[model samples]
Target: MKLHTIVGVALAVLVATAGVAAATPGANAQDSNSDDAAKQGPPSELPDPVPEFVSSIHDAVSDFLDGALDGSLGDAVNDVTGSSQSPPTSADR
Candidate 1:
């Protein structure tokens, strides 16, 4: 057999063995006490994992995109109707 063919077969066998091992129960079993860790949630004094600023920024971006899309649609309609009016600006709101 060619060298590449032999190497390919070896790699395939190794992958198959690994897959079988991973699928087998009791292989690298977790500790029986692992459930104890979940009993306690995040530390008491710590702030929320997600900060308010992150959410505010996300809301701002979402609002901006929504406004842009609305303007684009309005512009499309105006173009189709041969109206020369400009799209409404944020100040118009």
Candidate 2:
């Protein structure tokens, strides 16, 4: 199959390049970089937007469950009972 051929080629390439690698680092320069990085603290960057987006989605779902779906369920119950399909107001709570 095509997948088998692709995997076979990948393995062959890996074997061919197995010995090609960076030389081991010396003692002086490597320690200096690490020491500087430690002094610098965490990297400065824009906040990740993923959490905010996830929070918005969570809020939306909460709103739907707390209000929209609740009202719809009340309407459905009213319909079955041959009552007015109007949504429940706060005073009805």
Candidate 3:
């Protein structure tokens, strides 16, 4: 039961994290497309003028998010699930 639960939860996290990560670049592209369209022509139906900077920026952002997910963010999530410490009290302690 515990094994199944862990696997299930892990799968869920993997799926959700992937979904969230997927959105960042896609949303940016959509915005860029829209802006370009407004300034130029049809964005949703027609093709976009490919900017060289866009590819590099998208790659960099994807890399950063990937690193964050694999590094501190992963630690943060694990800490929440694995910690025994009491929830923080007032800072006056």
Candidate 4:
């Protein structure tokens, strides 16, 4: 429900802003400022996404998967066994 609301809002904003940049080549001029896109500068002052954060997330996921495997290895193996759990039928797909 929260996701739907956020997505709806985002879609609405995107729709509203659609063709806006192109409609006015002098976009900044409308706002009474520089009209150059590059001159406007990046909104985010920070650097591009840091690799350390990505590595941390990856490590966390790896630890979770490892723990899950250790705790439920049998269930995981059974999941792959066609005899135990048949492959998804067309209807399931």
TM-score winner among the candidates?
A: 1
Candidate 4 Cα misplacement greater than 4 A, ranges? 26-93
Q: How does candidate 3 fare on TM-score?
A: 0.29
Give the per-residue lDDT digits (tens) of candidate 1, residues 46-80: 77598555555455456557774344555555555
Please provide, for model 4 over 1-93, each residue's C-alpha lDDT reduced to its tens digit, 9 standing for 90 to 100.
Answer: 699999999999898798685686773354545366446657767768865445644554565577744434334444434248644557988
lDDT, candidates in the order shown: 0.69, 0.61, 0.62, 0.59
Candidate 2 deviant stretches above 4 angstroms: 1-29, 32-35, 44-54, 58-93
Clashing pairs in 2: none
Pairwise lDDT winner, candidates 1 and 4: 1
Clashes of each: 0, 0, 0, 0
Model 4 residue 4 lDDT score: 94
TM-score of each: 0.37, 0.23, 0.29, 0.24
lDDT (Cα, tens digit) per residue for candidate 2, span 1-93? 699999999998887666453344545544645767577656678676674445544554566677744445555445445566587689989
Give me the displacement of residue 88 in model 1, in angstroms. 38
- Candidate 4, which ten residues in sequence have the lowest lDDT sum? 73-82
Each model's Cα RMSD? 12.4, 13.9, 18.1, 15.4
Query: Lowest summed lDDT over 10 consecutive residues: which window, candidate 3?
Result: 69-78
Name every residue pair that clashes in candidate 4: none
Rank candidates by lDDT, best first.
1, 3, 2, 4
